[model samples]
Target chain A: MKKSFAILATTATLACVLANGTAQAGATLDAVKKKGFIQCGVSDGLPGFSYADDKGKFSGIDVDVCRAAAAALFGDAGKVKYTPLTAKERFTALQSGEIDVLSRNTTWTSTRDSALGLNFTGITYYDGQGFMVNKKLGVKSAKELDGATVCIQAGTTTELNLSDYFRANNMKYTPVTYDKSDESAKSLETGRCDVLTSDQSQLYAQRIKLATPDDFVVLPEVISKEPLGPAVRHGDDEWFDIVKWTLFAMVNTEEMGIDSKNVDEKLKSDNPDVKRLLGVEGDKGKDLGLPNDWVVQIVKQVGNYGEVFERNVGQGSPLKIERGLNALWSQGGLQYAPPVR
Target chain B: MADQQGGVAKPPFWNDPTIRSVAFQIIALCVVVGIGYYLFHNTQTNLQQRGIASGFGFLQNPAGFGIIQHLIPYNESDTYGRVFVVGLLNTLLVSVLGILLATFLGFVIGVARLSRNWLVAKLAMVYIEIFRNIPLLLQIFFWYFAVLRNVPSPRQSLELGDAVFLNIRGFYLPAPVFQPGFWVVPLTLLVGVIATVVVRRWAHRRQEMTGQPFHAFYAGLGLMLGLPLLAFALAGFPLAWDYPVLQGFNFQGGFVIIPELAALLFALSIYTAAFIAEIVRSGIQAVSHGQTEAAYSLGLKPGQTLRLVIIPQAMRVIIPPLTSQYLNLAKNSSLAAAIAYPDLVSIFAGTVLNQTGQAIEVIAMTMAVYLTVSLSISLLMNWYNRRAALMER
Candidate 1:
């Protein structure tokens, strides 16, 4: 009986191996063009990053990044399809070729970049971990939360940062974790936890979901640097360059004082830099295996970096987060782009 | 007898059934092993090419995440190896409690379904049908998200006398704080158990020899209860109960069972009991009516008929399927990931796997745990099944 059982187990294991044997490699660009749609991965429902409206239309800064990619490829921003993934599912989805570009609010860490077989293009949002607490707790600072219970989302850098901060300060805390951001926020609202911790941008996004958003305040302590960006699979360098340069063009357009409303007029400008960026005086787009008009399409359809950020997560939207660290290098921020020439 | 009969001396080795069977088995074994090696080789190459680590070294790294409920000592500074152990223990904790509760509830409801009273039987049937039809994941969500969320907060908790409190967070029960001289209580209990066993054996032999019944049940009960109480009085009751009190935003000074754990336990037991009830009911029904009638004809009471004749036979049919239900309950506890309960799947497979980016190693370890647990349960149940088998001449 034992021998037969061993035989059966061996056979089952062999069958599983055969079933999972297919490995996709290094043709994402061709595949995307053939399918005529970019398979983009986004967060499930993180407002200001990736969220859907009541009619099921996805709109966020990350969503606009995918739109820009779609416009660069097909001259149509609506040709991209979005697949909402949880924090735990995003990496595996990219590794298995289930999604072409992972534009979810994922942090770029050294370990992930080196070990996860993925390449992050550029920073889309500069965020840092922060804490939000109920005002009724009468806590002025995070140091007062020594013995508090905190609500945190699992499978994110925020969890690790919270642990490090508490341990460094010689404080003890109880963490009640949830699979989704909104669930953790709900737990906080229901008084199950005294504090909620996440990226400062996400704290604002989640706070708005509460019945009384005004009752809670984000603590004034930014704990860790979180450079959120879009990532792609590792084997295709051509696809990598396209995604990387697409982001740079957006930033460069913003640096040159270009917006969606003024893009048409700038196309006729005599300025050498504007002409080169608008793809009228250079072959930089052609060098990246795209048409010379690619940048024009992206700028016309998805707008510049400032326009997308403001409309989705800044002064034009409900989040109203300041562009403190996301402004261009000319404006004394870290967002500098190489010249288009 | 040494050779073959009624033919040429024995078929050649190639044509012999024994030789043919051996050859086929050898070929099959070789094929399976070859495929296994090929798969392993391919995985190694893929991992190297992708630059992902493919070893167990990550187990030594600090976990840096907190688990809400851990049976063993754990902190954020502990290693991933410790986290894995904590996760395994929590999984076993839920599975064991769920199995015990489900079995007890299953037996009661199964018997209630067979009751002669119309309302009792109908009620049991309704419960069985309702829970059995719904998906287990949906039930877990309903309990964790809907029911627990509606409970009152800690400051306004529903107090159960002065010993227990219930709220949105969970139940807080008074915990016993043992003093230095508390060893005498367990010692006395052990002595009482040994005395009961000796008395029961003596009574059994006495009844067998002289056909005079002995009251072993009452005598055993007295020793078990009276000895403990007497020991407690002699030892000055070296224990104190610490009740939970509202402190700031939550309760303190007692054993608090978190809402996640409670919701998971409640959902698992209730869902598993429905299927176990069906197994138990069918097992009892499988026993023939003739056995009960024969016991009745021998002037046996209804209780004696059930204890002596009906139950032993019913257990033979019940134990096999009942083992499967227990295994199912244990595996279903993995669904605790959906509700963020920090079971083995949530902490190790979900969080740890994401952090390390080592999918192959993490998943293999997780699968190995489940496989080992299942095999152990099967081995134990099979032993009991063999002992309970009917002997024949």
Candidate 2:
């Protein structure tokens, strides 16, 4: 017993020393600059959010957000690396400085914003909680899903929204929850659950992963609002601003009718708004501690917000999700950005 | 020689053994306290810097989520305290069931390994070797992902005699619903148990004093079983079974065990049983052969010699390691998180911790739980070990 105690004491002391040596807290921007790359947290393998292809190249709306941030900072979108995190690890990863930014399709909630020391930059996808069921089940709407078995991902807003929706409708259901969305989708596919509930965008993303994607149909009832966006740690306001404006620049460029394909040609235009946005007439980037051409770099490298959305998850992608609430405000939707000048 | 002859002066304080021992103990205590304080300080600073709340007040907040399996009545409207209880009860349920099943299977396999029949021994050896070699997590995955996933869907469930059904979702068994007068059965069973204990003591005393045997086992079994059955019949069989019927999407009106729970239970019990079997075999073998021979020389039958001689001695060797195995199985139930079994670690530590961002409170509570369980098991086993230990003059 004495010998074991001695060994345990030694191990504990060693562990303490190692832990103290590794924990170096500082400004996130300084760390990112020193490392010469931004470590962005992303989803493990959500298809239209942040999935890696067969050769390990990540391309999604969230991935593009990270790329846009990298472009604004270093003028090279390739200078960003991805750290895939699950729903449970995303916040802790950012708080620990393990990742510079989190673009993992996380929802913005008042509790998360104020309580968890996180700041959601801007909305990338406007979504709502929806249900998906097998065609053979003959369940056309969520109201008809009384006493149904539902598969949901734990530790997510979707789970809470699902509970609230069912309770409000005076319906009863059994929830079979999984830690990963993929597993929940698989459970739905195998008929272990009668319905799968999540954000509408995620349902579309997960549906295509099924063995027979055509066998399942997403129900029309959207139950709760879900504004998904990128987030950053709270203390580093400068880093937060940079990440936030990178997204804003994308939105503003799209609103200005300038995209990656025409950004270079639009720079030569005589429009004062275009001149001011492209850094020819104003110094909007100076206030942000960035280069005058930061917006130009983001637009040139990562394209406008619409282009990224369409290419990754919108009409041009396999998900084919319509831009219902995510369209620009002038075009009858909620996505509106502040003018650069 | 001169100092010894002169009645040696007192040793210096630094050189004194008593002083040195006390000093060393004091230093050890200080070190432990220092380290603990340092960790606490670091955690407080980190939590403050991160702006995460540090308290147990979150437990009173509504959970706002649904749990598939709960021992008591629960809903999304329940508080996080209820969720904690639900998670803890589910954990205890799995651990208790796993321990009972593992112990029984372990003893059978252990005895089979020592059987004189070559085939029986070889088969037991092969089973132990295979299960013990594979990792427990992989076995859980194999059972959940490979085996359970391939089972038929609810529409094409594998039915057994219109009573139970198996499908990819879960297993459905008849649930017993008892009427008001069902209390008589339990009351009779309790009486039978007390009577059995009294009879056992009387039989033991009679055998010790008069050297005569009593069939206490038969008497106890008859009383226990017959009394409950008689009471049940007298009450006009006030128990009914609720059988599952094929509903819209799944089975309705039955007791359902989710596939995750089933897979976790099977994996944990099967994996732990292999190690337990080895421990039991070694323990039995550790008993000297001379004792068995001595019993045989006394004209004791084989069964009597084995039970009255071997088992009593082997228990001394078997119990300490057996306690460890039971504790291990309890701790390993945390792996249920991987398969979504809604155990304490998954629901409270994993999901609740993530949602509330109260890492310190949640983790401390979880650690406290495991520590309490381990210490309790050790305390109980230690008491049993003390009684079973060899008494020396």
- Every model's DockQ, to 2 decimals? 0.37, 0.37
Query: What CAPRI-style quality would you assign to candidate 2?
Result: acceptable
Task: Give the worst 10-residue stretch by lDDT in candidate 2 chain B.
Answer: B25-34
lDDT of 2 at A155: 88
Give the number of the best model, judged by lDDT. Answer: 2
User: For model 1, how does the per-residue alpha-carbon lDDT over A69-129 read when each residue is reduced to its tens digit?
Assistant: 8888788999999999988878878876899999998999987788888899999999999
| Every candidate's lDDT | 0.88, 0.89
Give the Å shift of residue B98 in candidate 1: 0.3
Candidate 2 C-alpha lDDT tens digits along B193-250: 9999999999999999999999999999988999999999999999999999987777
Model 1 CA deviation exceeding 4 Å by range: A1-24, B1-27
